[model samples]
Target: MSLALKNEQYANELWRYKNTAGPQRQYFRMGLAAVLWRFLALHEGCVAAHCAVPGFGVVTTVPSTSGRDDHPLRTMVADMVGATRDRHRDLLTPAPNATSLGRTASPSRYTSSALWGENVLLIDDTWTTGHHAQSATAALKASGAGSVAVVVLGRHLNTTYGDTATHVEQARLRRFSWDACALRPWSHG
Candidate 1:
């Protein structure tokens, strides 16, 4: 199970900061890592059970289509889980021609190699349509990975609702409140 819901105020604030392209993004990334660490601390039994499994070699992340050399979540998760980042680096890569296909469209736009017989804990920032995670898992399995388990920071929610008794309108929804998670320090003032 994922740690949190993206529809929540704290998670949504972090998501917005993640999408921002500036120095502040780094701070948000650090904040996110701290939040994840706290969650893991609160769920030590879950972490212990996952760690007890044999052959759990390393942690890796789903590739980003933005062509970044590395994803912050990958690095942060590795640090939190006590895994070496470089060991699983380059395991999964996004195809050059990959496009941002929305949820419900699972495009084969990922590739993996050199993962034979390795057990990987795959991480992704958010779980949306899950196309990216599924594609990464399939590629890893096909490339002979012993196993792949996925973890996400948040699960995307479809928050829109019906306007009338019988008709539901699918409209974009945004939440501006920042009082959901007490750990979050920032707010929309």
Candidate 2:
């Protein structure tokens, strides 16, 4: 199930906050955590409750292609959901010398050999083509994970069409001011 539309200003802000590196990254990370927390709370029956049921062994994240061991989205989701760092394992690694899989690509960019027999709940920052998630899930199952479920912060959508592009532009302009500092609540600790 999708939570946010990629074209919306809030979602664009989230994507930018996640992908861009800067001083504001920390703030956006926290804001994203808060937003994700609220979303899970609202959809507890589907997300949190499902997790609470026994048999789900651990909560992990889709490994980032950036080569960073620590992913903000993964860490934040783990924190919000009460998953310890130990429980949130990085089971998958990027393929040998593979570069960032921009927009879309085959799922073979990642490889995993870790063994897990319990259920897994995978969290990701964004869903573009879902190749990342699909690849991770396949690896998990192949490695012996009983089952795998995915939750992503945003679903990216193409806005090339005239009407959709115009709507997205309007939403972006109306929902956010140019000066991000003014939007302190989203960044507040």
Candidate 3:
């Protein structure tokens, strides 16, 4: 399936309702997305991926498609978390796992120094496909992010950590070691 479609499907399968407004739901959504971001960063072995701050809302850009503008997966992530857009640097370089993955984090007009604000969260409501996350991450990386991650509210059961809630929980646990929470999913058990 297409990344966009997949993201939608994943979002639908993972979430029963859209509770972006509730404090509990919002926290959980951001937390879940943050967890996924850390997981991908550690799994991908990219230092740039480690430094994300999991934003909470949507970031809309390019190719305005009617309802697509409102896709939960695309609309729910916060904004860029830490680094300001000015921090980003437009350099065409391959992400650490570029070889395994056909896509690359090449430079683009989205370049800006403020893009690399402090630890930031590229939040999303759900993960039906991951296209939204993928694109957002690439943009963040290109904008000069030391690390970038796409946080989402929900994930598929097959991909969920399952009974290892404790293990998974550890990955996201943080104690204000820095200005932003260091949710390193890779270290989780």
Candidate with best lDDT? 2
Write down the TM-score for model 2.
0.66
Return whichever of 2 and 3 wins on lDDT: 2
Model 1 collision count: 0
Candidate 3 local lDDT, 1-189, one digit each (tens): 101122345454345334345675566445444544444333323324354334322232221122233443333222322221233222222334433433333333123344444443444444544554565566666565545544444543332435645543453474422223234533332
Candidate 3: segments with Cα more than 4 A from true spot: 1-114, 157-189
Clashes of each: 0, 0, 44
RMSD (Cα, Å) of candidate 3?
A: 11.2
TM-score of each: 0.66, 0.66, 0.34
Clashing pairs in 1: none
lDDT of 1 at 76: 79
Which scores greater on TM-score, model 1 or model 3? 1
lDDT per residue as tens, model 2, 1-189: 233455666577667676777777877777777766655444433543455545445767887787777777666866644433446666777776446555545456667666656877777877777888887787777778776777777776667644766765665574433222221333222
Candidate 3 structure lDDT: 0.39
Please estimate how well model 2 matches the true structure, expressed as its whole-model Cα lDDT. 0.64
Q: Model 2 RMSD to the real structure?
A: 8.2
